[model samples]
Target: MKAIQIATYNKNIIRALLGLKTVEKSAGSPGDDEVLVKMHAAPCNPSDIAFIQGTYNIVKSLPAVPGFEGAGTVVETGKNTGHLLGKKVSAFVQRDTDGTWAEFFVVHRDDLIVLKDEMDPDQAACFTVNPFTAYGLMEIALLRESKAVVQNAAGGQVAAFVRLMAAENGMEVINIVRKKESVDVLRQAGARHVLYENDEDFEQQLRGLCAELQATTAFDAVGGPLAGTIFNSLVPDAELVIYGGLSGKPVENLDVMGPIFQNKIISGFNLIDWKNELDAEDFEKISGFLQDKFIGGTYKTKIQGSTTLDKIVKGLRGYIANMSAGKILIRP
Candidate 1:
């Protein structure tokens, strides 16, 4: 099997720090609840990037195969595995001992999620992380009965999913982006509140939009002072959910007094922790709903390009160059 193995950590230019090495290994016999998957495709996500950079909260060993989610076909299964052979599925490899960036991968049979056949490989490749994050976070908004929500990185793939899900749930989003052009792009995708982080009216527009829509939930991906701006812009006693640290910096400009004065809450949302607390039934229900939405409408993700195993460096660099161009797929 061939895999892109990261042997060293590089805070900057993480893609260059990783390498694709041809590794020879045996297909271990599956256990009663395990399956062997012939990998078809995997998407390079922001989490993967952070993993290789050695900055993610989870620490991986040296010579790590860093990847989170992907889709493939089940070629073999254990005795306990029932009726799942030869099925194409989306898989999440949560084992700290293993990763999915390879020609073949193994996972628990129960963890294999059969995907919609009509779905594209790129979409299936991204089946778990972004889509679920967007879907699950929206539930938080719904629970708060928030009329409107705000999120950063409006030009990102997950941001698109957030906007689409919000629209379906009767919630408006104040899409925040560093680039001015993203305002138009998000607007075309049905975002009514698009604010530029670099604009002089950034704070003004944010305050006005929060006041107008009564936004009570902020899904922040880009950290740094951007989070602070978002925290301060929301309605009273709102929730600020930090999901990603795209800026690779601390959340700045936070509403320090909100918790004390307005009873506001600031929390973090990690997919792994969220998944752990959920029962199997709830996980499936949430995953299924998000998958249906993804296959149905604006949930479709645009793919920038595809690459094979040998072109791993090119693929990683390309994705790092401009992630918003589209989701990059590794056709292993």
Candidate 2:
């Protein structure tokens, strides 16, 4: 089988270690509660980059495949999971086994999300990550009865989903982006409150928006000073949820007084943890709801391009260069 293999971790240059190799891998009958999938498309996410650099939360042995999520057809299913055989599915895997970057993937049945027939293979390739993450974040916002929310990395796919979901529920979004051009891009996308963090008055603008909307919740993907900035700007009793550390820095300049006197809180959101917190039935319900949105064209991941396994390294380099533009999918 042809797979994208990372021979070693390269923090400095990802392409230095990434390559396509033909290996003797068996897609044998899956074990109990597992299924074998013939992968169609897999995406290159920032987490994939982190994994290649050996900085992600989940790490596999050397010379391993690097993708975590993808869409494929179920070729075989284990006992009690035969219902999934021949079904089109989007899978998320974190086991020691090779991942979705290969032509074949073996994952536990629980990690697969059954895709609606109308869902395109490319969109389904990205189904398990950003969409669920946005759903989870909005779940928190809805639970808090927040009228509006703030989020960094406004140009990313998850942020785009968050904005759309918030709008559907009559909630506002204060989007913060590092690049000035992103402000215009998001605004044209119908975002009402987009802020350029590089601007001189970014802090003042954020504070005003948070107060005016009474936005008590914020989702932070870029940590470091931006996390603290968002944390301090929200109204009293607000919660700042940190999910990704794209900035590669720790949260800084957080005002202790807010937590000590103003009822402010800092938290984290992990998609795996969020999913695990729900019962199987509830998870299935949410999955159905999200899939309907995709099938209806209410939600979609922006796709920049697609690549073959042989060109994965080149594709990844392009993706890392302009990440906010769109996703790069690997057609394995």
Clashing pairs in 1: 228-253
Model 1 TM-score, all chains together: 0.93
As a whole number from 0 to 100, the lDDT of residue 156 in candidate 1 is 89
Report the C-alpha lDDT of model 1 over 130-232, residue by residue, as the tens digit. 8887877887999999999999988888888888888888888888888777778778866788888999888988999998999999998988998988888
TM-score, prediction 2: 0.96
If scored against the real structure, what TM-score would every candidate get? Answer: 0.93, 0.96
Models, CA RMSD each: 1.9, 1.5
| C-alpha lDDT score of every prediction, in listed order | 0.80, 0.89
Highest-lDDT candidate: 2
Model 1 spans > 4 angstroms off: 14-22
Candidate 1 displacement at residue 307 in angstroms: 1.3
